[model samples]
Target: MWSMLMRKFRRFPVFSLDKRQWMKNVIHQEVGKGKRVIMFYVDIVKLTEVENRYGDVIAKRVLHIFERILPHVSRQVFEIRGNILAIQKLWGDDFAIYVSFGGDVNEEDCRMLSIHFQEQAEKQLNRQVSFVNREELRVHIGYAAISGQDIVKEMYTSVKRAAHMAKYGITSETYTHVTQFHQVLAEENVTMNFMPIVHLPDGETLGWEALARGPEGSPFATPSMLFRYAEETDTVFRLEHICRKRALEQLRYVKPQQKLFINLDPRAIDDPFLLRGEVFARFEQYGLNPYNIVFEITERHAISNYAVFRKIIEEYRKKGYLIAVDDAGAGYSSLESITEIYPDFIKLDMSLIRNVDVDPIKQALLETIVQFAEKVGCKIIAEGIETGRELETLIEVGVTYGQGYFLGKPDKGMGHASGQAMNFLRTMQEKKASVREEPFLFTPAMSEILAKTITVEKHVKVRRVHEIFEQNQRIESVVVLEEGRPVGLVMRFALYQVLGGQYGIALYYERPVSQIMNANPLIVTKDDKLDEVARRAMTRDAYHLYDVVIITGVEGEYIGIVTVQSLLDKMASIKLEMASSANPLTGLPGNVQIERELNKRIKQQVSQMVIYCDLDRFKWFNDRYGFETGDQIIVRTANLLKEAVMRCGSGDDFIGHIGGDDFILITKAAGADELISFLLEAFPLFFADIYEKRGLGEGAILSMSMAGVCMIPGLYENVEAIAERAAYVKKRAKELPGTVFLDERDCAADETHQTQV
Candidate 1:
């Protein structure tokens, strides 16, 4: 009789009606006052279908179970009704709860609460509703934290969007994709790999591009698959957020002054976390400055509104973050984006860079883009360079930077170009230097020649100085200093001579050495050239010629002492190396020397002009004339070129005989044009004399064609690319009649010049 009475009263209301209106008003008021609110949107998976299949009794029982358990999840829980317009459109079949927090709230607490409520609801619903071959009822929970004032609509939309994404796993056919995405989120499985963007000319790394990767062997293992699935499921914002966080975390190991490139999807820009200071804060946590970060705005998807996008990019720029327009030339929209935004870096699409070495059309297109970038004052980074030829071609075409398998593959750590990439760079650099004929000049400074020596104060006891000479048999001299300035020199033989005499120790052993010190010694600054110092040492009196040379700084502070033997040794070594590297016929520096000079200039960050000079019709002249006569002509031309350089260029300017009719000259950029013009005028006069002496016809006279390339050291990676460009300009010069000078300083300049032979 009790069981029958309870069944009759089972239909009575067990919970209060949904108070969505009251909850909405409360959320609005709290949000308006800048209080933090968290909204948990909970949806019963296929609830309507479950109700139809299992009857009203079971559906009502499932709702009653959620109402009883939600109070345990949070003290500020409120039931959401369908009356609120924003919540109604987004909530759909999902039941919503508003949880407000005062002061502070832990994100982990909210996550645990959502999980507990979902599990409890599922357990109760599964027990009450069952059928043949029926799927178990489950709950999908989505939550978002909202702060600041008057964003109730945005708050609801964000939570509702998250819920819809959470529910997609149950309703969509690709359940595995959804499940894997959630697992990644829970486990934080997203990670980043870095690929180096190297300066192609020198193989120096400019920066690394951070590439995102998901868990291995999963459907979302690759960035393309992962982002595509996220976009389809409306979880792109969350995925991008996780990716950015991981990228920033991995940047801790990056070297100082090296840039870090991080990709950002335009659609994810609206995320509150991204818009607020969260991303900047994360960077700060990793000790990364905003100036070192470059936000690569990827163009994989269309940007719906460029105005809004530009505004966001401008905001980031104002905070010292750089912007790069990625995948340029991939589509018209990317071009439009770059034009509208004027990014700091424009990355060329790999499609255009592929096989560029063999395809003239691709080269032309790349050349055009490089010109455009130069005009806009943006650097061009060629992407996907996979071969040596492609890298060489890019460098030849004046691309400032590049990244691809040819340089380095993406790895889990900061890596540099290796294997084939390093070998290719070295090989090209060597090839560029193969034409030089003179040994490179290496002048050792006083610092390198100085020998570490013992010094004594001017007032030291004579007995102690005598003991020092006796302790070290090889000691020739000791420096006496007043403070840090060298004032006197004490010779070991002189001290020994005075101290070895009878009664010498008793007479003067305890006195200060200032009485016996020479008070005059050879002193040279550290900046003094080795050769000059050696000459000064040789000019000393025969007895004192072997005395140590005291070295000092600019302020006259004693540094160390140098022996005559070390100076002679260094000078000998330099002479031997120079002799071995000089060209036999021209007696000038060769390839090895030229490369060393170029590297030194680059290291010193000097601005210089490199000129490639070739004699037109040299091969014909050599073939027609005897070998000896041809050699004579080559020698004569070298002499005239050297004369012109010495007359018009600085003493530090370099001249090299690159074998045969080719020569190289490195000089200051300001005087390079004048030097070339002088050579153009001087060479003909010498040729005229040779022609008159040999009784040769006008056909026998060959004119000189010079290609001059002006460069600043940091602007290029290596000398090979500069050499290649000079060769190209030389080829263009050969096309014109008579001796012509071609200027390829502006890479985009048209090929036309008016110069006489």
Candidate 2:
């Protein structure tokens, strides 16, 4: 049964074979073409021992199996780079294979390739042959880069010598790593840790990124060290599979709506088992949905042929498993990988996210990346967010999600951001979300007004709905259910169409209530914003518009309902409260709320700015121009303050009107000067606009002045102290020329000058 090639090889001795010489000449010719040839020299170790123990028959059979194994392994691993140029036996049980590349060998690439082929080859042979254990069946693997430049320099000749140098270049430490890594892969000595990737604004764990850890208390405990060993030993796929299996085992505990991110090597696509849908079976066995799985293709792995690789992963994408590119900003291949793969998520590098608050260049780069990610329909997940400032900056720059030691560390079980980090995110999130038309800081959801809704299964008789409605007059509506999800709505008035008629009760009472229920009633989630839910509810047609809005949890399990009556009442109440609290003219926060806001900011000990704005000639103009014209002027000043705050300050900034011609603005200390400068520059134009609007002659003049104080920690405990200081500064500011801004520096200079006098 031996193949013709095996029978032919037996006919000639090593020296008589013309193939070896022919291969060498072909390689030299390739080098002459200015291409680099990577030649791998492989031979079976202890071949004579196998012959001594099992006789020549078994030894020859082992040789045949290894020859078959070589080609298969080449197809799996070697095909990534290119096809093997030739395979020739140099001597008995000794062989060599050559592959050509377009460019010279990179030292790093060469090192990785050598370990990859050698370690992976030995593993494959032991697995296929099974004649000996992994240690017993050793394959001596060596490789060399033969290039035109090296040949011209006479640096490399005799493929055996060149290969020996490349092979022996590996240090002794690699042997220890190989031994340790082989043990780890064989025994699956690894554990998985889960870290939460949180939504930055709410700190919600959108998904858990699985991190692989080696045996505890070992040198390989860290992922970098453990994976390094795997790389040196050429067991990346084996190691990746073990980590993957362990992570998937936790899928039973993960919610169906939450995702579990698994690290994947691009080379994993070459696995025959994966191509045959083996992982899909694993997911089915775990009772986990593939929709909740995400495969992270690390940017560290270099893809040789993206055209082919792209087609391979299309199957996984079609199966509802999302893809993420990790360590995006740390590698050269990140942009290419993003463009080629168009992944669902992009995990930014730790280096780029660290200290991003202070680096304008990094901020600009990240902003651009965020925009690019948005354009490509991918969400950005910033990694290694260690500081509060970094978190705030990322949110400001519009990175949607993030994870780091500051947010949460990896844990044995799924975890969330710690309480401390949660408070930080909550405060910042509130501040950022503060720019809204609603009166409250956070929007109320449908749950706020969820009514006690009655429910009956769809198969129930219509008589049941009638009984529930009769038992409780306040239960205006009943939700028809199939399983736990709502299928239709039955209202008190809907009963009239059926039961109000003469034969309505006897004819329809015994049938399924689904027949009488409104098949397509309004249904909103419990967490939906109340305003949006109300908008949707009000838009319904006349008959069903007043019907209850069925509220459900995120998974569509029916929770309760919000009647149109209660929803409108809630909306009216919110409007009434807003009307009472907001200023009549400017519609900004009034005196009571401004005092409360300033006191709260003072107690928080945060660095901020309190700006007091006033008009110098306003009293004279108000007396000459009627109160109506003066009101217009006050409104114009309020508009000017809003423009400065909106253009320069953050969303968390506070603006208020203080009676006749005075106003207040609170913003962060960081941009206080810029905001003040913008107001001073624009205030003069606004002042002129007021006079021009009334058709007043050019002789009229109005002067505007603003006083700003930078409030650092312990600067003032109460709003009274801030008000008194700002009042004095405002008095000083009114003494200056038109449109002037005075800060702590100017106040200090005046006090110093007065003391010197």
Best by lDDT: 2
Q: Write the per-residue lDDT of candidate 2 for residues 614-645, one digit (tens) a residue.
A: 88888888888888878888888877777677
Give residue 600's error in model 1 in angstroms. Answer: 17
The C-alpha TM-scores of every prediction are: 0.47, 0.47
Residue 632 C-alpha lDDT in model 1:
89
lDDT of each: 0.72, 0.75
Off by over 4 Å in 2: 1-173, 270-287, 433-757
lDDT per residue for candidate 1 within 1-757, as digits (tens), equals 9998685344221222254444457667776765567666777777778689778777777666655544433332222211111222133345555555554556555555566656766776567554557877778876655553445455555564556555654334454465567568657799889999987667888789999899999888888888877776677877888887787776668653467888888888655554355664554455444556778888888888888888777666544457888898788598888888888888888988999999999898888888887676677899999998999899778887899987999999889988789889888765654433432355657897677767899779998898887788887888989988998788886676555544456645887776556554678999777777887676443334677889999899999999888888888987787789878888878888777767766665667888888998888878876788789888998777767665677656778888889998888887777788788787777878657877888766779888877777687677787778888888888887888788785433563332321
CA RMSD of all predictions: 22.8, 19.8
Cα error, candidate 2, residue 576 (Å): 22
**Model 2 weakest lDDT span, ten residues long:** 149-158
